[model samples]
Target chain A: MKLDSAGLEILSGGECLNLLASAPIGRIVFTDRALPAVQPVNFCLLDGNIVIRTAPGSKLAAAARNAVVAFEADDFDATFRTGWSVTAVGHARAVSEPEEIARLSALPLTPWVPGTHDHFIVMAPEQISGRRLSR
Target chain B: MKLDSAGLEILSGGECLNLLASAPIGRIVFTDRALPAVQPVNFCLLDGNIVIRTAPGSKLAAAARNAVVAFEADDFDATFRTGWSVTAVGHARAVSEPEEIARLSALPLTPWVPGTHDHFIVMAPEQISGRRLSR
Candidate 1:
């Protein structure tokens, strides 16, 4: 789909979600040290939840104890002059149950950056919304 | 500065911070119901804190009662072929004190979206970090 400058002005909700589903990575955003923070992670949309893996003492591990967090994924096609984004808001918690962890870990979520993928943080969405710039 | 594909690959820590300082809007990330959530907000890099305005029943109001959250902002320059981003992670709390609220509300944070902008949520960064993809 080729998009002109004008076509990139407004995006529909379905297109936004479709874009999000296709992207395998996104930025996990949260507050740390009284400031805004973001980190890149490999993610998967499983049964309507966002899941990622991290090591102990990592920010993801620490955030699992928090009450809420937000996650976002986006893609921009310069050639096509189009882009889409999706944002999810919900509670983040660590998945410690052996069965659940194993099941989630079995998914295809290989981190682009190499590190210990020990901890798993799941962001369960209470509300999912998005926007797009498309022709 | 003109950023080519290669020049946009590497971004210094200071550059990232400066980009963050210049931008007035960011995405607030949190967990709503075991799911990832994000909302756009007008923010300020005030005294090292990220602040935004919202209504009483808004997501920001509810997140203030939580222990932690994340915030992120980014800018992409297709012309210059460069982009920069910054992320903050820390605890989020509501500014209840009248004086503090008044002081924060005084900042130039006009909502791009129309609605009741009453409640104020502050993301106090325990850790601030960023990266840039430059050419």
Candidate 2:
């Protein structure tokens, strides 16, 4: 279906979650020294939380500890100028329990960057919103 | 050149600016009620600043006033697992002068979302960084 260039459809919560689940990567936005920062990372959705692996002592692992952050993912086509974006905002916490970490590691998430990924950060989303632009 | 997965090449300042100038879309990260929030936007590089158009009094326009924000743009190939990302951190200010707004409107920035985008937000970057990953 060809949508109007001005059409921006607001997605429902279920739609947002479904789109998020279909993608394997997203950018995590967090604050560092009172300034906003963003990093692209591969993530997975499990048990209503967005989970990602990070190296120990990394800025992401350090700043995201029990802090509120935003996660965004989008698929855009520059040629067609059509795409959809989803943003989930919530509190991020480090996965401490070894058993839970093992369980999460078993999930289908692989670190895009090469390194020893020893820590898992889970963002239990309190808000999920998305928009799709088509033409 | 096929780069190893472990090789994440750091981009220099000129490289970052060149990448930023090559893309017309990016995500703007800012604080909303002290929580990090991200929104995908269409922007252009002008006179060493990242300029974007937004609707007046929107959350982005409101929170970004004199605020330190982050702007990010990237292109990744999911199949090949290779991409580059550029991020700029700086202060955002509203462009109130009519002449400046008129001049920016003449630039190549076209907002993807349809609306009356009368307000222009200029991000004067203080720091710019980027990374390129390859297989």
Candidate 3:
């Protein structure tokens, strides 16, 4: 679909989801201390949810406790002027089952920051939506 | 400071803050439904905090219940390759006081989404950090 904006193109649903599945990193959006917040997170798609590992006292641990939040992943190539974004709105909670933790740990996501990866936060989507912009 | 990325020049602290102050729209990040989430929010900088209006059943109302979330705002001009980003990390909570709500409503922030603007989420930053990239 063509977007009204100059040099903007809307992507099909299949193409948008494909971009999301292939992208390794995305940004998570939430409220921190009563304001808007975002952070770059390395995540993997597991059982139709986004899984991320964090430190005990990290922001991720604090934001995922029994609340609804939004997660977005996007890929942009300036040279090509092509980009796609996938947003998931869902509830966030900690994954504490020993077996689940072990399984999640096996995923390819590794925290670039130095810390113990004890806190596992998962975003389960109640609604999954996406859009793509291209030139 | 100089960043190695091409066409990406680091912004001074003051300049970055200025851009943040001027931008009227931004995206909020949090965890929801067990994953990372993001939503576009209209906000105003008030007393060293970011404030937004939302519906009671909306995602914003859910993410801010009790979490450490990250909030970020950025402005970019592709033609000039100039942009700046401001990110805040802090706790989120509901504002229940009648006097405070009345005061906050007076701010320029008006919810564009259709709903009762009954939920007021605030993000009080423990740390405010920002960066700007210019050509």
Candidate 4:
């Protein structure tokens, strides 16, 4: 395993994707009012793309329209300080076509909140990286 | 319990701070190379300011210098779809004064990774808001 300058193990592309696929919740970072804002979201990986189901006309859905955003997920044991973090930088675009939405609707995408979350935002990562730290 | 248009309970300032005080870790949103990025950092509340200890010359340390960044913390039962999220938008400034740094070093803020984490960044929230979602 290759180690970064920070002593954390650098995860390969496959390792990063596998780790991302295992986590149920992740954080999405976007420019809100010209400042950085983060919102925790439950997301899933579909066809190697990060897919998010959010409420229509929501802040996230509006800000994520064809914009470059960052997605991060991790599982860390605060007690032991041993964990892995995966971050994907991508262009987030809303899926408006019916055929495309229909295909994504078949996925296991479920929102934690009880609301109308028909808007689908798919992010195809341009850069994916992660690191693993051992206690 | 006051509810927003989305039906989530709007938490008061006291409630927000109490919830933030209970979390061991949170995600810091800051602009990186002209794009938004999120990194999970273990933090603590000091005099109602969000304090984080990180490597001296780290990316987070550099980007967070005297900038308006957003900090978010939450505790959620993903399975039951219940949780609360608190977000604080504030200006992040590096604590350079020896006496100030010395005081912050005394806090319970401990970095998850082992290293020389003497640099301190304190964010005094200008706008703090949060909401709780029920199962």
Give TM per candidate.
0.56, 0.93, 0.55, 0.96
User: Per-residue alpha-carbon lDDT of model 4 for B1-135, expressed as tens digits?
Assistant: 998766789999999999999988888899889877888888989889999999999999999999999998887777787899999999999999999999999998877776689999999998898999986
RMSD vs true structure, all candidates: 8.9, 3.1, 9.4, 1.3
**CA lDDT, every model vs. true structure:** 0.66, 0.87, 0.68, 0.89
C-alpha DockQ of every model: 0.14, 0.63, 0.19, 0.66
User: What is the alpha-carbon interface RMSD for each candidate?
Assistant: 8.2, 2.2, 9.7, 1.4
lDDT per residue (tens digit) for residues B8-121 in model 2: 788888888998888867999998887788988888888879998988968889999999899999988777888899999999999999999899889887777777888999
Off by over 4 Å in 1: A1-13, A18-37, A40-85, A88-128, A131-135, B1-16, B77-81
On lDDT, who's better, 1 or 3?
A: 3
lDDT of 3 at A92: 85
Candidate 1 chain A has its poorest 10 consecutive residues by lDDT at A2-11
| Model 3 chain B: lowest-lDDT 10 consecutive positions | B3-12
Segments in model 2 whose C-alpha atoms lie over 4 Å from true places? A1-7, B1-7
Any runs in candidate 3 off by more than 4 Å, and if so which?
A1-128, A131-135, B1-16
Q: A24-94, model 4: which lDDT tens digit per residue? A: 78889898878777888888898899999999989999899999999999888777888998999999999
Higher DockQ: candidate 3 or 4?
4
Please identify which of the two predictions, 3 or 4, would achieve the higher lDDT against the true structure. Answer: 4
CA lDDT of A72 in candidate 4? 90
Q: What's the C-alpha lDDT at position A7 in model 1?
A: 31
Give the best candidate by TM-score: 4
Error of 2 at B114 (Å): 2.0
